[model samples]
Target: MELKEKLNILADSAKYDASCSSSGSMRKGEIGSAHISGICHSFSADGRCISLLKILLTNVCIFDCKYCLNRRSNNIKRAMFTPEEICTITLNFYKRNYIEGLFLSSGIIKSPDYTMEQIIKTVELLRYKYHFGGYIHAKAIPGANMYLLKKLGSLVDRMSANVELPTEDGLKLLAPDKSSDKVSKIMQYVKNSQNKNFVPAGQSTQMIIGASRETDLDIMQKAEDMYQNYKLKRVFYSAYIPVNQDKCLPSLITPPLKRENRLYETDWLLRYYGFKVSDLLDDDNPNLNILVDPKASWALKHLDEFPKEINKASYQDLLRVPGIGVKSAKRIIKSRQYFRLEFKDLKRMGVVLKRSKYFITCNGKFDLNKEFLKKEFIEANLVLGEKANSSSNIYQLELFHE
Candidate 1:
């Protein structure tokens, strides 16, 4: 087949593997379709999701991981593009103002080592041979030889290996052919390259949510480890959309988007809000609280910890308050020294007191819950847009965008 025809076949094939940060309801991604979440997020001189000419180098594999459509044993049509062909496509796309670079991934063509070699060659040809320096995002095959990984590390702007599933058991059941250990080792290897922060952009990985019996706790534990140990920029969670659901996978009931959103919120708390994984989950309660954001839930569960004075509170203590985010807490430290803060100043400082009020005290007074008996009443009174109501009540709120 011709290069564009093979490109079409392979790009269509690459969209189903869900390690990407896809947002739109895209059924497939070809050249003209531009909004894939995991590609080269650069813009043209014209601003668009036109950074990377994202495509697969090939769709032929030698391993039959059951969750993957391109698994070796699956009786699907196959295709491969050479390094020269890929260079031609990326250069053509770049010249036409279609993309800034290329995002390349592939199935295991012969062995992990051979596949890694081919993927690396494609990026190196674009970078060295063609003097193309835009941006390249490569997916390093987890079990590929280490030498190839070190070489590819220096060539691309970013790299990833899909964690595929949250738990070892889930991986064993769904993608029985891939290894969590091998994937983790690669993440660590990439992290080790950041001594002088040489690999400045850092690394990221994706986990498949709702694929197995693992809870949000399970996913977050691994995510925490990846952040602490591997120093990953982000650990993406792809909702399991059941492309190849066998009886072994979980029941396909609801769209996994809600659970996916919950995970993203939890991840946000861990990275920015100083939350520990145990703060969200425990040995008894293994799942995240679906009713509130993880921070709010943590605050509600530990009510004895509340009504903290905004004036006397430490930075670490301020972070523990439900509605006070990192940005808001920092602002309070600076602004409060100039004046004794009132209920109005907290709002001006961008604290969402509808969610934050029950947990904090202004000059040692709690208007929202003076009695402090009805946790149910407090929970019920809290509506999402209560801050925007502009009504006069104890729950009247004030906040700003920072």
Candidate 2:
């Protein structure tokens, strides 16, 4: 087939993989440069937007993953790109400024090892033959040979081996061909590799939420384990978009985008805000509150800790407050050393006083009237604020038309 036809087929097939963000790789090359923060329409750590040409090497798979669009049983346009073609397209796109790098993945073309070899050959051509230095994020095929994994890691800036489902039961029920043990081994290999240059951006993985019956707590617990044990840089949550019909899968017409967003928010809290899964969930409440954010929900439940005096609270304490972020909390720490922080100072430092005022105090005085302190009132306001800030009008409109 022609290159354009192959690109169209494979690119469309690869859209379901959401673990393509690139970061922590910096190299100066003869033709292109990989910035520290780059992904498809994703911002880097320093806040620069970067784009990549995300595509699959081939859509022909040996495994029949029930949630995947390109399963072996599915009737779809199949295509494969030779190593030379991949190099040609990448260089041409880079030269034209159409993309900063490439995010490449593939299905089981022949075997895991064979697929890894093909991916390695394509990236080797770009790295050695063409001297393209742009950011490349590749998927690490589970059960591939260890040597091939190491070689691919050395060549790419970031790598991901998707865990697909949140739990082992979910894996067996929906995707029996995939082994959670193999995925864990891949993550462990990346973490334990002595070579500092192997996957300089570290490794990340994608998990499909809403595909199985796992609760939000189950997912967050799995993510926590990956972060603590594998030292993973990220665990991307892709809400399950049903592409195939199966008796085992949920028969939802729409993807659970809100649950995915809530998971992401909870993930940020676990990573940056020093929150434990136990702090936000329990046996009684195993899922995140869809109405308010995880942080706000947690704060609402623990109202006895509220009205915290901003001047006296620790940095960690400031972080627990509803509206203060890491940057704002640090500012509070630095600014309070010189003078007492009032509501105005908190606002200037980027605190969302609309939410914080209900839970915090400035010099032992609440910013708003005491009437706002009622639990019911605070919860209502938080819900309203979340609804106002949500960008769900498009989804709602589509639902209405349907």
Candidate 3:
């Protein structure tokens, strides 16, 4: 098929792979600049605006991963882009200022090594032949040769190997060809190859949520293990979007978007806030409280920790208070050094007093209405508050073409 048609097909197929974070990269290309902070519009570190050409090299696959849209059993129009074609597309797009970088992934064709070679050739053409230094994020094919993985890592700024499912049983049932051990080994290889030029942005992986029977606690524990053991930069969560009818797949019409958002929030807590997996969940309560955020849920469960003195609280203590994020906590600390802060000052400093006022006291004075101070009332309010703040997007799915 022609390249534009292929682009649409492959890009749509690649949307399921959510490991496309662009943090931890800094480079001055011949055309544009890639900051160390990040390059993508979403999950950007330094708030720098940038776009990526997110597409797959090919939509043809040999493995019939039950949960995947590009599986071999799925009768979909297939497309593959030659390495030179990809380099040309990237350069032309970059020249037009359409995108700053590329996020390339692909399904296996011929063999793992051959498929990986095709991906690496695209990167090689972009970097050496075209002298394109824009940020590149490539996926390391699981079970591909270690040499190819290293070579690809050397060419791209960021590399990732997706651990698609959370549990081994899920892998066995849905995706038999993919093994957790292979994905883990590839991640270890990337972590060990953190030199000056090779994958300078570090590595990340993705986990498909709601596809299997794994609990939220189980997923969080696995993420914790990946962070500690692999030293991964990020663990992305993609809620299952069931497109094909299969006995192994869940019968869902819509994606578990709320679950995905809550997972992202919980992940932020684990990464930024000093929160453990156990702190957010227990043996009895496995799923996250979707009505309230993870931090707010924690605060409600441990009410004794509430009414923390804002003036006397440490920076860490301030972080524990609901609605006081990292920036607000730092602001509180910095502003407190100059003079005592009051409720108005907290609002000026960017604290979300609507949530924090219930958990904090300014100079030993509770400013909330005494009638709404009950735990049940506060919980109900938080739920309503979440619904009021939630927003949804509607995406029109393109008609299937062959």
Q: For this target, which candidate reaches the highest TM-score against the unseen true structure?
A: 2
Compose the digit string of candidate 2's lDDT tens values, residues 1-402.
888999999888988777656567787678998777664555556333447788999999999989999999999989999999998998998888878789999999889999999999999999998888988889999999999999999998888999988899999998889999999999999999825478888899999988899999899999999999999999999989888999998898778887888899999999999999999988799988777899999999899888789999998898999999999999999999999888888899999998888988888899878876899999999888877887775345433543
List candidate 3 stretches off by more than 4 Å.
40-50, 369-372, 391-402
* Candidate maximizing lDDT: 2
TM-score per model over all chains: 0.82, 0.94, 0.93
**What C-alpha lDDT values do all the predictions have?**
0.74, 0.88, 0.84
- Candidate 1 deviates by what RMSD? 8.0
lDDT of 1 at 367: 48
Residue-wise lDDT of candidate 1 within 262-341, one digit each (tens)?
A: 68989998898778999889879888754456777787778888878988898888998877889999998888888878
TM-score for candidate 1, please give it: 0.82
Cα distance off (Å), candidate 1, residue 294? 1.0
Predicted candidate 3 versus true structure: per-residue lDDT over 314-378, tens digit per residue: 88889888899999999999889999889999999999988888888899887887667789988
**Backbone clashes, candidate 1:** 2
